[model samples]
Target: MVKTKVITIASVSGGGKTAVTEELRKRLSTSEALYFDEYDFEGAPDDLVKWVEEGPDYNQWNLEPLKADLESFLEREEPPAYIIIDYPFSYKNDKLKDFIDLSIYIATPLDIAMARRILREHLKKTSIEINDELDYYLKFGRVAYLEMENAIKLNSDFIVAGTLKVIDIVDAILNKIETL
Candidate 1:
């Protein structure tokens, strides 16, 4: 079976990874996309702090099924042209190393990420709750992002500024793919 071209768009929360992935989906033909945030893990806690600090073991994720799902796609009669994963944890997953043809890091700074996260998440939350959320993110999310940044940078094939317009990022990636 021919191997599918797998791409990972990784960044911390509110880093515009979703925007880039959405743009990619719209622009790419015959593409299958996966969002890590959408994954349903049986024993996973809703608590972000515990999930981040406890690391991979304590955080339950049904990723084995994803591996199989990806394999199924690759083995198909006409395999998908691309598989894009918009998630932060790809750096830590060795299983994906062989599958991923390219890794793109959306390098959004911490302050920008915080602003975006607060803006996106504050809709249903009260002001006080939003403050608490920011605090929690500052304490735990920042730590997790910091810990993962170096590894992600080293693994990435391309580093794009996360603050750029999604269309620009899309154009950059499309051009890069054409060259490749």
Candidate 2:
């Protein structure tokens, strides 16, 4: 059996990972798509800054389920030909790094990333809730993103600008897959 191709798209918060992942999903109709943020919550304390600074892992999201899901899919007689995961933290997760066939990072400036996060929060969360989350991003998210950005950049096969035309990245991936 041909093994499944796993593509991980990593980026800092609000760095266009979801938007690009959506486009990839539309284009890769046969592939499976995983959204990390869907599992981003685990009922942790409301204070995210303290959570991060006080020895709590910033990436507290449950990923073992996603790993298990991927394993079960791969075990199937007919698994998806490709799997696309919109996730970050390749440098922090050994298992994630091992699972990736292709790694892509959506590069965005920190200022733009934080701005997008604020905009996204305004659309989704209550003002009071958004303030707390924004505080977390400002206090902890920036440091974490910088660390992740540097590590994943060294580990990625392609680093594309978040503002780049999607067709270009999609075409690039498709072309590479054809060669492989």
Candidate 3:
């Protein structure tokens, strides 16, 4: 049986995790990718501030759905050579840590991430909506991003510059994986 290597790319919002995962999947013919945001995980907090204040337990966001999906890939008779995931917590979540063969953190500056998020997600929003989002980021989102980044960065096996082009980031990841 072939062992499918799981590589998780972690980053704050708009920090290139998804982009890297997608590009990596394209480059590796025998690979598939999963995204954390694509699932509605149970136990995820409704309020970001409250969660952060309450110790921001990474496990609080139940990753069972993601886990199940990951298992599906692993359980396949002909498992893909690589399973790339656009995940945020890296190995922080105890439940999912065992399955992760490699964890990568994308260290994007917060300001750049915020700008990208605004442009990508809020471009069609009214000024008031944009302002509201920015206000929320200032008051709560920044802290949450920092919390996740600091925690994940410490646990990741590799770190990449989020400012790099997606292809460059993917190349770095591929080179790192090849060395392993």
**Best-matching candidate per lDDT:** 3
Q: Tens digits of per-residue lDDT for model 1 on 1-180?
A: 545688889887888898899889788888888887776755656775566666644225546656677788788889988888886655456545668888888888888888898888777888889888778766666766774576676668888887788899888888777755
Local accuracy by lDDT, each model? 0.76, 0.73, 0.89
Question: Candidates 2 and 3: which is better by lDDT?
Answer: 3
TM-score for each candidate, following the candidate numbering: 0.84, 0.75, 0.96
lDDT by residue (1-180, candidate 2, tens digit) is 677888888888778777777778778757888887776445434764455456555345446767887787778878988888888765356546678888888788777888887886678778788888778776666666766566666667878876666677666666666765
Evaluate model 3: give its lDDT.
0.89
Ten-residue region with minimum lDDT total, candidate 1: 56-65
Give model 1 RMSD, 1 decimal.
2.8
Model 2 TM-score (2 dp): 0.75
Which is the better candidate, 1 or 3, if ranked by TM-score?
Answer: 3
The sequence of per-residue lDDT tens digits that candidate 3 reaches over residues 48-123 is 8778877878888889999999999888889999999999888889889999999999999989999999899987
What's the lDDT for residue 54 in model 3?
Answer: 74
Model 1 CA deviation exceeding 4 Å by range: 1-3, 42-62
Candidates sorted by TM-score, best first: 3, 1, 2
**Residue 147 of candidate 1: its Cα lDDT?**
49
